[model samples]
Target: MDVVKPKNQRSKRALEKRAPKLIENPKTAMFVRGGHISQIVTDVMTDLCKLKRPNAVLYRKKNATRPFEDPTTIEFFSQKSDASLFMYGSHNKKRPHNIVFGRMFDHHLLDMIELGVEQYKPMSSFTSIKSSVGIKPCLIFSGDSFETEPNYAKLKNLLIDFFHGSDVERVDLSSLETVITFTVSDGKIFMRVYHIALKKSGTRTPRVELEEMGPSLDLVLRRTHIASSELFKLATRRPKALKPKKEKNISKDPFGSKLARIHMTRQDMKQLKTRRVKGLKRKRDTAQEEGEGTESSPKRQN
Candidate 1:
């Protein structure tokens, strides 16, 4: 038997199956901690400023000491500023030349990853800067095994989130005019920013040509994304069961380990008490006898 679904029901199901897209209607506010910003971190900040419209982006520098250690305070400030994303950079002997990227979840600072940059090339270093302002560069993510590789899939989603655009596409042989492409190969992700041009053919549309742009850096991602559902479950999880505690025995000495109890009788207690009293009386009597002898000798001398 064949059954036909109603139009409204079909439309509802179609909408249910579609993934929800987060649009940047209110420009995402960002917070940066006050510190010495490295060249790599500065270029990344510049790239983000370009990506996020100038008027829409809001940022502030805060003097923070080890901001990553306390996420709750950061979340407090983030919520106060109505910010959804924040970035901070730090350099020290233990951890040198690293930048942290974090996003808020429900006004709470959520996942964060610190990437250590090995090398950096700033955009100003380039002599021929053809990339004009307000030309929304097309970002492309390309990997043959992205569909099957879990890490690749996650990395792709992260890239899409950081870039914040619905127009970003996956690269293919047909993809000709991609401005930036992130290609994963041999467990390494390579980033390429280019300027593309179209050359007209005899009777067909122009073929695409790519020119390398400046300020390229490598990124190594660490896998640490916790699923929202899993985090929720952890938050609502029950306390662990407490183990039964061992009872203390009164007969044994609490200060001694594996010591046997020595029982004393009433006679032993009485003997100790008598000995203490006798010792005190003997000392008093001796002092009195010496005082009497000294008084008798003093009268004869006078």
Candidate 2:
């Protein structure tokens, strides 16, 4: 994409929004429906756009894109919109109800993983209660596959990046009204979203419960375009300014928890100064009279 010179302040602000950052902003996703999208896939995209709102852009018109065949098409869209993440939905005989989840780095495709939706339930299926738009979702991933299988692990990371929302210093419990759960089992991924219901429990903290809020999906793993380890490392590398500087006596373990070492010279117990107590002080000896008195000394009358 060519860098367009800004003609006005509005255009300059637009360019600044797309510029790189040390503390990157929340990832914005562009929702695109393919030429042959099904109603189920379209609804899924719509519900997802609702959740990603304010930061997301939904292209109402269907577009022609085969990411596996011509990746440049999606790459072009990504560049034009200045969005790093995207969801593309399409359907066909072979891969019915197909959806692609992808992310870009430096305006280039970093990763794209496709999943075929086997079963889907739209938001309309659920009741009236639903989460507000653009709330950061609490992501929960279950099953061992997400950790053991390479592809599943990558997909887990991609989903997290797409839905985690913007970063914040502290989150109010009341603001936590949405959850997205992903479970891996039997070579399939089950996805669910819930709205947290806070009811009075007769206590300071309210009782929390989950109400099924729609867009439930059962998906089967399909094609994937994952960047190599080196490329991925480069794309995910943190800015030097954001990284913690190595301190002289402090270090972090694999878990990122800090550990510190103290340096001190050896001490001589005898010479070391410590709190003094009368009990611990040495007693001084007084010299005795050279000769002992034979008789009791006469008491002087006062």
Supply every candidate's count of residue pairs whose N, Cα or C atoms clash at under 3 angstroms: 0, 0
Q: Please give, for residues 1-302, the per-residue lDDT of candidate 2 as tens digits.
A: 99679999998998888788899888889998898999889989998898899889899898887888887988898899888999999999989999999999988899999999999889889894898877889999999999999999999999999987899999988899888899998999999999999999999988989999977999999999999999999998999899987689988999999999999999899898989776666554111221234234665799
lDDT assessment of candidate 2: 0.89
**lDDT, model 1:** 0.58
lDDT of 1 by residue, 127-152 (tens): 54456544455778887856787656
What is the Cα root-mean-square deviation between model 2 and the actual structure? 5.6
* Candidate number of the best TM-score: 2
Against the true structure, what is every candidate's RMSD? 25.6, 5.6
Best by lDDT: 2
Stretches of candidate 2 exceeding 4 Å from the true structure? 1-8, 251-260, 264-302
TM value for model 2: 0.83
Model 1 deviation from the true structure expressed as Cα RMSD, one decimal place: 25.6
